[model samples]
Target chain A: MSTSRELTRCKTFIPGFDLISNGGLPAGRTTLVSGGPGSAKTILAAQFLAEGIRNASQPGCFVTFEEQPADIRRNLASFGWNIEKWEDENKWIFVDGSLHPKDEPVMVGDYDLGGLMARVNHAVRTINAQRVSLDSIGAMLVQFGMPVVIRRELYRVAWQLREMDVTSIITAEHTGQAEAPVEEYVADNVIILRNTLEEEKRRRTLEILKFRGASHLKGEFPFTISEDSGIILLPLSSIELRQKSSDKRITSGISELDAMCGGGFYRDSVVLVSGATGTGKTLTATQFLAALGEDERGLLFAFEESRDQLYRNALGWGVDFPSLEAAGRLRIVSEYPEVAAPEDHLLRIKKQIEDFQPTRTAVDSLSALERISTVRTFREFVLALTSYLKDKQIAGVFTSTTPSLLGGSTVTEAHISSVTDSIILLRYVEAFGEMRRGITVLKMRGSQHDRNIREYSIDSGGMHIGEPFRGISGILSGQFTHSTSSELQTLHRMFENDDEES
Target chain B: MCKDFLGNHVMLEIIDVLQRPDEAENEKILATPTLIRQSPGPARRLVGDLGEPDRLIQLLGLQDHIRPRQ
Candidate 1:
């Protein structure tokens, strides 16, 4: 029995088809690559041979029964492999198995793949081919009418190739049957490639259905075939790369804001600052940039404010934009929601992240993003942006403007709340005939935080957070009444009665 | 309905529901905007626009911790 610790060491390699047969086709075993028309069986087989030649410095052989050698060469040209050049260097071999008109026909009992097997053996021995790909076994099977004869010939060919000590990939055409071909049952591996339509979108997927003698991943893997890169497999769905924990924290620049966040926000955490207009959402975000000190780098993406106005307004908040820019720690980019797509914005931010490598990033207000696309698109954008920031392990702060300050209504900012690791709510609270600002920590995932609603104020010196309310009523409703007055009178009467009794 | 001051002594779960009432309330039974203070004592229910944290604090007789309004 395997313990948890021992089981953790097991790793599987996807051999471009059902799991690569334990240590990849037994180092000298025969495997089959079978698929229907346009199933990319040839491409898969060729890629296996090509990858070995390029990556492993191991020579390989490609025997084609369907397409001409020139056509295969042209098709794989985009992947930067020169098969013809490799053939000249005596490192790779390509064999054309198309029958000629002058070839003589023989009886079923006398017919054999003796010539084909000899050529394959010679190619492996002469070029030192470590890998070999037979484009399609279907053509060979078609030539033999009797199932028993065909099966016997295929078995003989597989054993001969194994004796040559080459990792062989035999290709077959799938006929949409519930059961695989007879050759597949005898082979060491079986892989299936297919296209599926989901929600009117066509997706190309690959699954390793079986790999004999090997424990393989059984789920379908999503991949894309580009004109330049051919097939590029994305990260598998099963693996999760966790973010490294750090002790560093980011300041909101505003002293009051920083205090509300338990001294400061954690490094690499996403913070959502949501408030109504004129409540200083952008100012709070700018304060965050200003508090980074002279050495720390900060990036600010303003979708609503222009470059000049942003600088001027930030200056009003006592932030030294000129000096920060001169020190090479602060970068500001102005974006327009109407003119650019979300992808364009993502690319621009990605470039900035690469160039500046800032420790902190702020999206000045998500309201602008709402104007550019549908809710679904906006959500996707937020997810992608958060994923990108998490990849860089940079602390990000996003400001969102709620439509109103009171009553139960969807705070336009609701869409992005889930993606943010923390939410800081700023709003106006009325008390004693005056409107005061209040701040509260709505949620802070994976960290402990103060939950009390504290009164906050902003003046020439910047923001300030005060103690919690003492003896008032209706704090969230922007109204506060003194309950102490009536209670004090009652206490005085009780004291007088106690004195009389004494 | 009851009110209190010094929300520090308030039930944490009640505070959570009060902060985001829209999400906590169930509309299936015509249960419009109900606030259930489920901690620090017996649970109490308050209906209507209980948006004013100060008033709720006062009605709950928790003014000792609350400071006098400026």
Candidate 2:
């Protein structure tokens, strides 16, 4: 709102879209939407108008050249958009440019979009529409079979829309992944939606290719089309690292572990519990979630185990998950990671956390989800979930199952180690030919923590962190070399001499 | 063709897209020599050359409006 002012933007009100677009599409201008077949380009265009009507109470016009108006009404109805009712209410209008099979127009000479333009103009005028969507301009391109003329006509149409002062979207088909359609030059703004199958998993992303006079977040942001909510973006890169740090500490439920973490973890920090199979990572997460105070609530996204299995496991560790849940202090959502895509899972998890208003959350074994996604997708998922929890100021404990049972890191830890505030490594230690479990505070941010690898035992009463392992070396590297007490004394002397020199 | 079909009875309104672009745009008159029934209960349109008088009349449902050329 200054003398040297930027173009006022028209907010689409699509979830996460406005945020990434830096306050929505440039107002009073047309933005070309390009994507491949089935990339939801039409949906995005229609949603530009639908969201305008539903959220801003702004009337909109839909000019379809590909699908008939009847089919559009029915197809978009699944999104809970009552187009017919909106049309009657004068909130939405459609200018049908779709040619019928029985009455295909005879092209004798030069032509223009004059008819389509007039219809759209009348439709907009009738409703005083603020938004317009021209879906799949590729159809018009095919109908004319002249890219030059079509592009020129489209430029005229875009200019006409600007004259109407309606912020609009014109969707065109992107022929391939690498090909840029010539029609994109019709508008100053461009957005591309991609639905790609990476590593046998479907991943959808939306990227703002160019904004002529506007600023926006760059790069492809992962998005998902929910059953009810259409397209939702996980704009993790937009999350600022500005969460206020809390000095208040909360226990890990295990006192020795708390002492090792220097009087417990920060109230709103994320902890990663990494372990191999049978190393009690879930137990660690359960303990972290179970330590919730009376007023505090915990939400557990159990990915590796079901509700009954988690309950039984917690019961075996002397924690009554059922009663805690019944008392409304805790909520557990256990599901198989294969049920949904990573983006969908993030949405569902975020929804659950929002609905429950939890003070802390534990996603037991995030490694389960890694199997269903590519490395990059899995990393983004973790980063997104971690940032969400941090932004909410909710403490989170996510367990990552390491592939190697004896010791060694996992792809999950490799990806998400920097995102989390602390990493609690659980390992299987071999001592005197006996399989013993060990726990260590690998790293803690902004806190003093014990560096010793302590022995821990899981029993009916749960895990107990005992003293640090003695006369052992290379436990972290999965190599167990036991040393005699005399050799340990020599090693202590060597450290003692080095300490004296320092 | 339309003159041969039913000449003096049908009133013709001609629009050159070059001349009245706004009116052409408003009426969606894209092609040259396009014919439209403006006052009919439902508007009927034919784009390009209106070939074959009988077929054009049938296509436009102009039987009632047609009288033997006066």
Candidate 3:
């Protein structure tokens, strides 16, 4: 043991989960995992047991009360958890407590789960199991109609399992009752899994409400279940904020914009470029990636466009993406947001960043990710992703779409700009009868930045930042009016204090 | 009513075999909704609905002393 606190942990090998649970579950204690249907509670319990077998060489027993043993085995086989092989080796035991009755009515108070407990005990004793999981005590509760009797039998089962000195996980279904379930009171630890509909998209979260002997993170954490990785927990609070500031700087790939951002964006800093449609957000992000040196690496996560589309579009800007890839300096990852949750997308990006070791990263637009989740969850996801990148000392460039073509206000701006280190606003300015693009440095932390709203154009030559929009007012409000030189000087003098405050 | 009639007529033990699957398997009870007359001589098994009181009483050899449903 590395420290005195390490004595009580069982160390479940699920990734990103153990850190949030202080270390792992309290050793030799029962954990209650209660959730609704399709919440992946069973998968988590199964992963706990499988990880024990594969990593710690600790034998386990799975007392299945809901699914048949063979069916469970076959279902878990899709996850590559070979239950049969482990069972055949005597290192694992599977007890089937499924009620296989044809039509027999289970009378109340008559069925005490004695038969099921006997089988579980036998299996545990045979394997000398170190871990045991009763997959859902709810199945038995339905058989024994009385809640008091079910509670008593469940407590009895939990006590018996504890007496065997094995770490146990018992699953329960959320009955939609006002009061907490009996299993929550009986177990040493309780974790709830929730699968909810938010804006017509499914969001999954895991929350550890109680741990008997260990301190844990005190809020709900988002998680996802991949076919390959059983249950991936994204404990955002587990990541420590990187407080050390970096003095180094990286280019924005466009020279004029870099000059406006006070010698490019600070190294390992997050920069947000907010704009409406057709405002060159993607082009600006790709330019940032193109600015990386031949040795330094960059990764672009294009949420809206396909890889080929980004490549073809960048070619129009006289940027050769294939050459950068050949030189091993750039990688573009395009993923469809409609298929998975935001956590899944973040996990994939984390994996790619870890493997590629990119010095700089870019998410072309966060609005697409927002479409896949609720606004609150998307903000959390963005915060975690940006913090993780900063901890790795990787400069990040993220683009967000404003709802109005005219720069009024947007949800993305209100939520994302606070988390980012710098903000650059791009808007459409109607000077006369024609529309033109204008750019401004809204905020840059830890350094001085250009406060002027400049005119910009995007064509085959990419974004060319021209001179600041002189003798013009209300450029960002979409109602542009020409002003005299004296009026421009007076206007600048009036907003000088405001610029300093901003 | 059938249970009441059986109790009034015969001295027998009624056990819900589902409470003990091992015991049920030991008795070679393969299907459910099954009634096994364990002792009066040789064991006989009757399967399906026992909702019909007269048919159940007759099948269990209790026809000699049939009671009306009160």
Candidate 4:
């Protein structure tokens, strides 16, 4: 009879990579890092090995098939990594695995990887290396033409590394066409790096395609390669850590809009208010914030308007900004389009979220966020921000301006529609020879809401949602085409006549 | 109607009963998660997940008396 015993798995909390990976790379296994030229494949591999040596105090070996030891040492020295010092301390080993000049060519029948295996074994045995990185398996693949021989050699290398309890990272250059060969199947993990040109700008991305013996997050994580940090992987998923809070309602000060949002905004729901320019989008958002009173904290990130101008316009709407500011419940951050990047805006909002911990947040127009990058990047930015808000359980209101009031449902503000939990569309409708406002709830996930277009108006007292149009067609198109049915017209006249007689 | 150990009054009032006796014989009779206001005036029921205390109070017409905990 065999007794079941629990095995404890060791985890490394690598500084930059750990957070994105949920922890460090899986230990005691093989991880394949594949990418094209200038895709940071070598840098990423070195990051894993260097991080292990520095942070975890685990010795690692770097086996290079392309670069010489002197060049590799010199290149890494610029990144502030003292490879010689670590080598002298016996904590690191850099082995040159390139093809030698005097090495004799072998026949197809008796191909041998015994020499390469012996070198790897020696490095592991001498340094007690816990991590081993083969820099360019592509070069090795070119040298060994036969698939069967290459596969056998790789399998043997992986088996020996496993037996010696070494976590190996094997890197290969992707041909920018098909997937890498045999590595995904033979190795325990596979990570693919891609550099795509979006809107004439280059965007670098990293994706963990496969990881055996463990459950991994499946998504393309955007990353950057810099001189300061070799490779920084930004997890596509938002930070999920948030403090739980009691549920409470914050009013929009507009009674009609409140009814549309199921009695104002819920504790942590994200409300996206989209409309055209000069349609009072910012005013509506400010009115919502102003209704929170002098006690509850509310923050606004305005990308279009200046802070002074926003305050003045908000003051025109009868909002008490001075009192709200004095009470420390209201804060507005104005940013210009030229000075800020999407990451800068995200980081600033993240810092504010950490500092104020506001119950409510309003981004006065996602239009600027859309202009900062391509549609995909903008989508990611919105997703990351929404994820942050959802994790915090904070009720957020995002305002965006559309190019046309009667345009198609396709929003010009990137792909923000899908990321938003609820979409409140406000547009100017032409009726009775006057332009009137109409509000409609496009979609609200996880909750039931009214789906009818309600006529709304804004004045001194704020916005008011009135009855829906009864005798109109094409309400969403702003201009309604009313049918002139003689019978209905006579019935209306009859009712008016009866009222006059009474 | 009965009282729990917390000294709060609880009830399983089925206003529209049209079924068999066995169907209603369960010890814990289930109803919609609704808050029935019977204190100030005419009774009213507010339904759905009442996660927001302030919205619940306003919906129940008890915003004047129900003070939120800071």
Candidate 5:
């Protein structure tokens, strides 16, 4: 209770959890984690102890008032926690408080829970444990059916755990549909786990409701469970925006496009190329990744096409994908967005980026993945990927397909415009009864870029940027406005200001 | 303590908690003074000081089991 010293924190070593918790749980304090059934509450509690044993060699004690210790051990073995071996090595202990049906005790007069406390204390001392988990105080209510006694005893247990100097998590069950829980005042630090269904998709999130006297990232962070790992949270807000700006330039592989982007794209920048299906958005991403340096590698995630189709398309564009991959420089992974959730897709994409350690990555057609995620989730996915690449000083190209074939702004571009360093728009321009293509650098950060809409055509060699499209207006909003004879002269005067005449 | 009430009908089994800690833990015995009516339909357990003989029988619902010593 001393306010003079800074509170210590205990890192759980759960992936992405420590970052969002601003280090970890408050040290030597009792944190009550409340969630509904099947919300992975038990898994999280066990992981707190398991990670302690695995990461730091710190022993732990589990005081369960519901499920049997054997059941917990068996259920959590998929997480690679060998509870039986830990018990044999004196690194883990379980104070089984499970109310065996045959051994159910009757409460005629009065009781104190001294026996349970004694067992818990004995187990803690047995291993010199630094962490402890009390699985669900709600079950104890069923056993005793006395709310007053349980509340008093729970407060006492919290104090006792503090005295023992162990970081602990006491899990409790709450109805998921309700917006409030009665146990908000039960503990100083509280975390809530929610598994909610939105738009027929299950989204699991972990929210730190309050951390008394400590700093933590507020709001819910999306999380996913994998077979190898129990629960992995995507701490989007934890990603710092203070990425080092790199002045170094890399080519977009298209010579005219590079000249238009003020020499070239920044080395650590994320360029979002947005266009319709036939406007060659994928071609722009492909060219960007193909411009990797001699020794540098490239990673491409193709969500719209298969491996052979991508290779064939690249070969048609005069870029040999098979030989580049043979040289150990290029790696391509293609998958449908419906195969996994947005969190899982991001995790897998990140895994590839880490494993390959590429200098550049191109996700061909980010719009393909957008269909599987909600607007908010898609924004987070793009932000996470963009920041991840920028932090590593890796250039990225994310292609997004607009909903319409003509000049139109895509939803993906609108959501991720601020996150990307540069935005390139490719549109279908219907000029003089002929459907033509045009490209323009819409926005660029910290660099002067070509602002005029220039006509471009996709050939066997790739996108070739030609002369600027004059006398055209409203090409961005999926409309064409022809200029009058007098207005065309004024447009010519504006082009004369560009100093392009030889 | 309740020997007078169930003189002939009761089969008294005394259990020392310190010596038989396993049995105490098995029964989830947290308190010292405890009484259990094992047989005669559904079993029942009454813990703590029984206070009086009538209250003990009333609490345990063993009014029929209570009889005078032969």
Candidate 6:
């Protein structure tokens, strides 16, 4: 086990996939890339070859069995990998194994791929390549008719590649089987890529099936392919639940509310401010940003509102967001939640956090994120995001809008509250014949908090935490009942009588 | 309803009030199981069920509503 831990890993340039694999495609071994049509199989194989040639200065041989070399070059140019340049510089070799009309006429009844192997071997020796890719081994398998013949030929190729001692990737189509019959027992490692519709939007996910003599993160990680970033994998399984705990606390901008929270929220803690619509959720989040020190920076991800709209709203609450932005103490990123996958959202937030390195972060409302994906995906996104922030030791404040005006609902109730270190519930309490907003510290993990449901109001001064609702009951239930004056007087008289008798 | 009035009257009434849309909005009858008495010196409104008879009587001065059990 320890030896495997210390085993040398060939890091792939394909971002998060390598991280999840514990290391990239075990060194000097074969990895099978299985996926359906248009599932990024060819792109991954090309990236592996390109990554090797460019980063490691390790020349590679891309043996294409489907697309012609020229066509491959055309496709790879979009990824900014100049295949022609590498080929001309003698740093890379392209072995076109694609079946042509000439090969069709030359074929006989009894045949062997000895000629193909010779061509690949000559190319590998020419460049002294360190990596090799056999894209769409399925195409070659189809060329060989019988299953027994295909398996025998594949084993021979696998053996030859093993003898060559260069890391290799063989791409194949997933034929609805655990181990696709052809390359079943051949490859040292197997990775399956899936492209399926999730709520009418395309969602791509990849999973590692088997890693010989190595342990890897075990789960299907979501990925996306873009023009710029070829294949971006969001590996949730690789994320360790090891966040450093801090004794320090950060203020929520509202001093009284901070006081109620027993000296504010803990630094590196995830605090959720959940309430109904139009109940000052965003305003409270702005106050959190305002509370940052002069040198400290805050990053706000506004999903429900635009950056300009947030600025206007914060200005109304006297947050001075414009001044903060001008002073370089704040960054507000506004984007629609439905525009991308939940995994993309995680990666985008991570990218922002890395670039901005903010002391504080606030997602204006996580409720909108719930609308973009399934509940399971949303939960994973939230957990992954919060744990990541905690790892960075940044104070994160997320706002969620509850559906009900009284006491229930919001994303917090969707088990998001359990992951958060603190939960503050804001609700509308009817008092004095009008709707009045109230705030309460529902749960504060690892800290003492005032449990009283204090009436609060949003005004020009922002959210002000006033005294606890005195002589009233059922505030949380949305029922307002003030102590009856006559009853109070009777109680006072009774108390006086008892005092006089004593 | 009688069991709740005998049991945790205040809690039951609060829950009941929260469930109802109209009654919870009413400023006069804010809480549920609101027991109101008229023509008893002066009208009085009690927020919850009259769990404790003596306290309820003194609160609303409802002497007529109180019936002594044999």
Q: What is the DockQ of each candidate?
A: 0.00, 0.23, 0.07, 0.00, 0.32, 0.00
DockQ of 6: 0.00
Q: Give the C-alpha miss distance for residue A451 in model 5, angstroms.
A: 1.9
Model 5 ranges off by over 4 Å = A1-5, A484-486, A491-502, B5-70
True contacts kept of each: 0.00, 0.22, 0.01, 0.00, 0.28, 0.00
The TM-score-based order of candidates, best leading, equals 2, 5, 3, 6, 4, 1
Model 5 TM-score (2 dp): 0.89
Across all candidates, the chain A TM-score values are 0.61, 0.96, 0.89, 0.70, 0.94, 0.89
Local distance difference test, each candidate: 0.66, 0.85, 0.80, 0.68, 0.85, 0.77
Off-target runs (Cα >4 Å) in candidate 2 are A1-5, B4-6, B9-33, B36-70
lDDT tens digits, residue span A1-502, model 3: 4457644889899887888887888887788999988998889888998989988999989877688789888888888889999999887787766655543342311335555566666678778999998888778666445677667777888888889888899899985458877677766789998888777887888889998757888888888887776888888756676557799888888899989988988888998888899888998898888888656899999889998899899999989998998888899888888767888898889989999999989998888988887877887888889888888889898998888898676677787677789988899987767788899989999899999999999878789999998777887776667998888788788899789899
lDDT of 5 by residue, A1-502 (tens): 4544557899999999999998899999999999988899999999999999999999999988889998999998988889999999999988887777864665656656656666676678778999999998888888777777777778888899999999999999878764556676657999999988877787889999999988889999999887777889999867888899999999999999988999999999999998888788878877877787877899999998999999999988888899989998999999998999999998998889889999989998788898888888888988898999999999999998888888777788888899899999999998889999899999989999999999998899998999999787888886898888799888778899887763
- How well docked is model 3, in DockQ terms? 0.07
| Tens digit of per-residue lDDT, candidate 6, span B1-70 | 3232233332223423333433322322211344544444344545333566566556655444444443
lDDT, candidate 6, at A409: 63
Q: What i-RMS does each candidate reach, in Å?
A: 41.3, 5.0, 8.8, 38.3, 3.4, 44.1
Model 3, range B23-63, lDDT digits (tens) per residue? 55344332344566755645666644465666666666777
**lDDT (10s digit) by residue, model 2, range A368-476:** 9998988888888898999889989999998888888888889988988888999999999998989998999999999999999999999988899898999888888
The 10-residue segment of model 4 chain A with minimum total lDDT is A1-10
- How many Å off is the CA of A355 in candidate 6? 2.2
Q: Write the per-residue lDDT of candidate 4 for residues B1-70, one digit (tens) a residue.
A: 1222212432345432123222221211112233445556565544334555555555656545533333
Tens digit of lDDT per residue, candidate 1, span A356-415?
999889998777877775565466567767767876888898888767674122344476
Return the TM-score for each candidate structure.
Answer: 0.55, 0.90, 0.81, 0.63, 0.89, 0.78
Which CAPRI level is candidate 4?
A: incorrect
Question: Candidate 2 at residue A444, lDDT?
Answer: 94
User: Model 5, residue A276: displacement in angstroms?
Assistant: 0.9
